[model samples]
Target: MVAFLDEGGMVDFTIEYELTPDEVGRALHRGLKLQLRAVRLAVPTILAVSGITCLLVDAIGLGVGMLAGAVLFPFVLAWSARRLAKRQLTYLCVPTTLRFTDDGYEYRTDQSATTMRWPLFGRVVSTPEFWLLFVGKQCSAFLPRRAFTSEQQAELDGFFAARQKAGAL
Candidate 1:
């Protein structure tokens, strides 16, 4: 179980979990959706255009193939992303702990620790299963919803909302 503490003027929490390949895959997919909206849309649009162009050129089989490929693009993309995420996870499968505080957040593993100020996070994205903190165009960390109790989740949500309102995110 995770723990939340209030000390001085700061509210903090500590989370420890073994990083899993499936989790990594989900994170990658979420990051892609959040950061590459145009690219995602363009791939299908380009494929559809190729399909139409092939039909105009009287290449029935090629047009059908392009159309079919467009239809299957999402599945193919997800499969490839999962494969890539799994490969990347091989080096990241470590027991990790994250500490969230009013000033910033800290990430720790057996070998090293790193901290970043709250302003460094560019955005906060909440999915049903995880809250992804993005730094620049990539996700820096993801906190699973299951790690927090309902009350704690509410507190965390409120904290983020307040930060967003202040233009801190």
Candidate 2:
């Protein structure tokens, strides 16, 4: 197990996790959703329908514009997502050693290591399968639920809750 010193200079706990591609995909998808929360995702659907209506009415210019908007941007996002994932795949598709303390957390992979205090994460979100840590809209950490025992998850929940209650998270 990995170990990191807490504020009290005590080694706290560790969780070893190996990330899978499907989990990475879910993480990326959730990260994208967080980033795009303010964006009008419905634009594509609306534009597609509008484009069809415009074509039906013989408004070629508007139809093409709407269709183009509906078609191109999502493809761009998809392409970018694919490209980004490919670039980061090597780093992600490895074993990870997560060391943590009451003060912060240390994320370690063979490619890189990062340490961040709890306050650095502006948001913490939980899905059925993951714990997502965010700094602004960017996803900073992906903690798979499968990695933790139920007791560990509960401990983390309490830890997070305490931080949140203290307005430190």
Candidate 3:
């Protein structure tokens, strides 16, 4: 198990696991849903308008096309997101470990390791299952809530709160 010592002399928790494809896919999909709210709404709205226009103009072909697109678009989006997530996770196939501390965080993989200071994250987003740390508009790292014990989770929550209050994230 990996660990880190904070400035307060407390040992921070470590999480070690191989991230599954499903987890990555779900996270990606969730992020897309949150970030692309307008797109999500526009797709359906446009499809509905197309269908209504076709009906008003008595064009069966246009109506069928809109219907087909409405039915197929979501499946296409999900499939594409899953494929991209799978490709991204292939590079992270090795067992990965993350150590969280008050000052920063460190991640280790079979191939390499890196440490990042807290200020490097421009934003911190908390989802139901994971905490996504963003650098600019891209998510830099994700921490699964299940990886930590209750006490460790509390420590992490406090750490995030302090960072937010300090305008570090």
Candidate 4:
């Protein structure tokens, strides 16, 4: 057994689980969707409109390129983001255990262990399936939601909400 306590003397959430390639892929896909939502929408809109403008002006070469970019950029980006999951998940050669508390989080695997403070993370974003911890604009860690029981999920939600309210996150 292990005890994880905050300064307020509350025990936090503990999670242990292995991530399948598919889950990793889905999480990565969702993370990218979150990060790129505006870009994805705006880029294609601009490209398509520009493509139409160029075509109307009889700039065939530029129009084709713009049209192609409009059609291909988002698809290629989405595909690359999905493929990135397979490569990134290879580091988890074994299941991992994670403990969350007000101070920070501790991560442990068969070969490695580390702890990081919550402030080191710029934001925490939860998808339907996972929690993504972002450092800068990149996602540095993902915790599978399935690892948490309903009570633990509530604990985690409260933890982050409190942190956000405190302006610590």
Between candidates 1 and 3, the TM-score winner: 1
TM-score ranking, high to low: 4, 1, 3, 2
Task: Summarize candidate 3's per-residue lDDT along 1-169 as a digit string, tens digits.
Answer: 5445568776576889777777777777776666666776789779978987897899988887897887777788778878878888875656988877767888899888999998888877787687888787776677777777766767677778778888988
Instruction: Write down the TM-score of every candidate.
Output: 0.82, 0.77, 0.78, 0.86
Taking the tens digit of each residue's C-alpha lDDT, what string does model 4 give over 26-128?
8888878877788889998999999999999999999999999999988899889977877887666369888877788898988789999989988898667
Q: Where does model 3 exceed 4 Å of error?
A: 2-14
- Each candidate's root-mean-square deviation in Å? 2.5, 3.7, 2.8, 2.4
- Candidate 4: clashing pairs of residues: none
lDDT for model 3, on a 0 to 1 scale? 0.77
Which portions of model 2 show Cα errors greater than 4 Å? 1-11, 40-59, 71-79
Q: Which residue pairs come into collision in candidate 2?
A: none
Residue 58 in model 2: lDDT:
100
Instruction: Give candidate 4's whole-model lDDT.
Output: 0.81
Which should have the higher lDDT, number 1 or number 3?
Answer: 1
State in Å the error of residue 133, model 2. Answer: 1.1
Write candidate 1's Cα lDDT for 24-101 as tens digits.
Answer: 778778877777777678888898899999999999899999999888988887787788787878555688787888
Q: In angstroms, give how far residue 45 of model 4 lies from its true place.
A: 2.3
Please name the candidate that would achieve the greatest TM-score relative to the true structure. 4
Candidate 2's residue-wise lDDT over 26-110, tens digit each?
A: 7777777776765547778889999999999999999999999988877777667677777777898899888778889888988
